[model samples]
Target: MSVPVLRGMRWWDIAPVLDLEYELFPEDAWSPGMFWSELAHARGPQATRHYVVAQDPAEGRIVGYAGLAAAGGLGDVQTIAVARDQWGTGLGARLLTDLLQHATAFECDEVLLEVRVDNTRAQKLYERFGFEPIGFRRGYYQPGNIDALVMRLHVHDAQGTGNHG
Candidate 1:
């Protein structure tokens, strides 16, 4: 697979994004309405959300996508997914890097995310980015009763670099 280019996700990307979303998280994939709602706040000066799609330039296809929501000096990772075949190709890190950089732009003091307890792969990715396991949400994933591992990453101002940031 070719290296994908990350660009701002648009309303039209919903259909393809949903395809990947359902493929990656069939039991708990986000619906088209959910994505539409997020994109609704993703533009303009008052924007509180940042969403991006990783498009493989050669094929002009969305290979991955991610989103972040910011408010009250805090940022939350809403979602992050990469094509199965693209796993271990560092696309996940690239997508996450985009979100964290945007988090700083939004003046966020910290960022948080939740991963299924069984998703050690995702947990490891977050941990590599200095996300610390803060807590857990019992049965957060519906239809399966899967627990969620909550992780937090404190953000330091751009001018200064912390051990984690």
Candidate 2:
């Protein structure tokens, strides 16, 4: 299999991204309007959002996508998803690394995210990236009434000398 390529997500990629999004998170997939709103702030010099998609070079299909929003020296991971077949392939890590890099570029001192409490796979991935659980949101995921684990990571400064915290 060819290595997937990672590139800034464009408006045209939403359809495929939504397909993957629904496939991975059928019960809580983001609506088209939500994606549109995120993409709206992804461009321009004053952009506060960064979104990216991973495409299979051989098939030219979107296999993964991730988004981040930064403001007030903080970054929040909006979403991250990888195709079932792509699981255990480090695609999630790559997507997250991209988001963290963008967070640093946005001058964010910390990054935050919420993951389904039942998603141990994703939790382990976040832990591998130095994230630590700080709290939980009860019944955060609707329709299923699943809790969410809130995690945070302290980003290193531009000089890479130490964490921004």
Question: Candidate 2: global Cα-lDDT?
Answer: 0.91
Candidate 2 off by > 4 Å? 157-165
Instruction: Write candidate 2's Cα lDDT for 132-164 as tens digits.
Output: 999999998988899999999888633353332
Candidate 1 Cα outliers beyond 4 Å, as residue runs: 157-165
Could you tell me which 10 consecutive residues in candidate 1 have the lowest summed lDDT? 156-165
